[model samples]
Target chain A: MKTVIIKYNAGNVSSVSFALERIGINALISENAEEIKSADKIIFPGVGEAGSAMNYLRQNKLDEVIHSLTQPILGICLGMQLMCNYSEEGKTNCLGIFDQNVKLFPLSELKVPQVGWNTITDLKTNLFSGIIENEYQYLVHSYYVELSAYTIAQTNYGISFSSALNKNNFYGVQFHPERSGAAGQKILENFIKL
Target chain B: MLSKRIISCLDIKDGRTVKGVNFENIIDAGDPVELAIAYAQQGIDELVFLDITASNEKRKILVDLVSRISRQVNIPFTVGGGISSVEDVSVLLNSGADKVSINSAAVKDPGLLKKMAGQFGSQCIVVAIDTKFENNDWWVYINGGQINTGIKAVDWAKKITELGAGEILLTSMNNDGTKKGFAVNITKQISEAVNIPVIASGGAGTMQHFKEIFISGKADAALAASIFHYKEIEVLELKKYLKNNNLEIRI
Candidate 1:
């Protein structure tokens, strides 16, 4: 099966491609709309800031291309944040695919970036088919999507937030499944099988 | 809940895992990539590969090693050692390293942390501070804990966070190689002073040490090298022990 990872000006795309390689899937990293549209499955992987990322997506018109894709597509970390309706980070508007807004975690005793491992619970989508509840996932993000109707999985860091979102064929995860261990690999496998 | 992380650090010299006692009397451990895979399978929360290779080919060798680990291992890892510029950080991150830890380079030029964080978000930038307790307060050191920077550890931790560091790797020169436990006092000082997560490094002898660092030290993560390399304590056992102690670990 053909899987295309949408290439943009974001970081960590290489790791996702490498993670796919470990699972025996040689996905193509391309920014070409034609290659992305023709793929049987599309993966939108991202790291870095939301404002500049949106600027890059809009400049290359990949925003429109992503909105038009019907294949099973996965958005990861910053890619998942970009799929929301809006983000408090840089006050930028997002792709609005999940009907949710990404928010910066409130200033508290806890760290800002929320680096390291956190558990993902309330799994309700095929993206986490075999993954057990309270499974630890690697997360490093300050912004999170609030628990919404589209939230497929939830995690708490002082307060509960959406760790994963799903709508139709679109899937989004705030954690890096590529960086997470075996549980994360299983999630990727389930996503591929879908 | 966000779990306290247990990170296994590998000192890479010429692409081989090497362990030095207090930065001296080096001993070869094993292949870094193989050790990394084993650590990942042991359910370690994260890995940090400190590139201690002091050759001109350090960058190339470290990059290749990082790419290999990223392909074979399925856990988050941070790469550090002699990274000074934005170009170095870009090269390592582009090569699939999840994070780049800056130690002496960040001390030499504090602006490096701000610039790197602005260019590539704060989450990916980790500032490693090597400090030793002296004259009634802990002071910062550079050049692998040989040269004292005369700066207070607490003040430096706060400064780096303001400069856009998302995490702090607080290594206690006094506690390192002691195998007594972590420097809980200074670790708690830095952890409470900074808004970013603090990773307690240097001294770790038992699973109880991990528990103390997480609970009393208030550290977000704990990192160790020798105990893990020599198989003094199995990672899975340590994790299970920490979990049994109710430390909220990933086991």
Candidate 2:
């Protein structure tokens, strides 16, 4: 199976590729629209500010290509944020794969960039197949998307939010499955089969 | 719920883990990669690789090694030591390290912290401060603790966050390797002063020490080496102890 990881100006491109290789699948990392459109699976991984990353996507015309892909696409971290209708990060618009708005965690007592392992409770999709309920997944980000019709899982970090979302062929996880160990490996395996 | 973290640190010499590989009489602490895998399975919150003597050439091999390890380990891993430039941090992060800790470089040129934080978001930049209590105050030390910067440790900790550091790795020179306990006074001081997470390092002996560091020290996480490296304490047991005490922990 041909797996292509979109290589925009985002972090975790190498991480996404390496994660796939660990699961016995060699994925191609490229910004080329053709490779992304032709792949059996497309992984969009980002750990960056949305404004600049969106600029790269629009300038390279990769945004249009991503919108046209029909294969199973997975977005991790900021990649998932950009798949939303809009984002508070840099006040940028996103791909509308999931009709939701991304906003910054409230200026509350909890820390920004909640970096560590958090449990993804209230599972609702096969993306978590072979993974136990309340299994911990690694996450690192400041902005978050609240629960919506597309949200398949939930997590509480100061406030309850959509830990993972699904809209037909497009799926997004706020957590880093690649960085999440055995349960994460299982999630990747399930995604590949999907 | 955001839980407290237990981080296991591995010190490397040249590209090898500083275990039996270098010392004939010492116990083979096992391969660093294998040890890291064990920690992940044991539910250690994070893993830190510190190449104490990392040189230019050694860093290249370390990047390649990190790529291999990250695929298997799957936990948030941080690489530190000899990271003096944006390129160094980029290479390490590109090799699959989630974060890169900068030490003396941040002291020599404070601008590096902003540059690193800008290039790769603040979440990836960890500023490690090696501090010692002297003259009734904790002062920052550089050049592996040989020279003191004379910068007050608490002042430096606050400055790091202002300069865009996402976390601070505070290591007390006096308590490091002593196995007594953490410098709760200093750790709590810095933890309270900074909004970002403070990882208390140095002088961790018992499970109670970890608990004290978490509660008294007010540290979001605690890092230790000899205890975990020598197999004196297990990550699971420590987490259990912290959990029994009603502390939120990942298991």
Best by DockQ: 1
List ranges where model 1 is wrong by over 4 Å.
Answer: B20-29
Looking at model 2, the pairs that clash are none
lDDT measured at residue B7 in model 2 versus the true structure, 0 to 100: 96
Weakest 10 consecutive residues of candidate 2 chain A by summed lDDT: A106-115
Pick out the ten consecutive residues of candidate 2 chain B with the lowest summed lDDT: B20-29
Candidate 1 residue-wise lDDT, A154-180, digit = tens: 999988999999999999999999988
lDDT of 2 by residue, A92-190 (tens): 998888999999886456667787878888887788877888898888888899998898988999899998999988999999998888888899899
Please give, as one word, the docking class of candidate 1: high
lDDT of 1 by residue, B1-251 (tens): 88889898988888877763222122333677777777777788899998888876657988998889888888999999999999999999999999999999899999988999999999999999999999999999999889999899999998999999989999999999999999999999988888899999988998888889999999999999899777788888998888888878887
- Highest TM-score model number: 1
Which regions in candidate 2 have their CA more than 4 angstroms from the true location?
Answer: B20-30
Residue B248 of model 1 has an lDDT of: 86
Steric collisions counted per model? 0, 0
Candidate 1, chain B, TM-score (2 decimals): 0.94
TM-score of each: 0.97, 0.95
Per-model DockQ against the true two-chain complex: 0.88, 0.68
- Residue pairs in collision within model 1: none
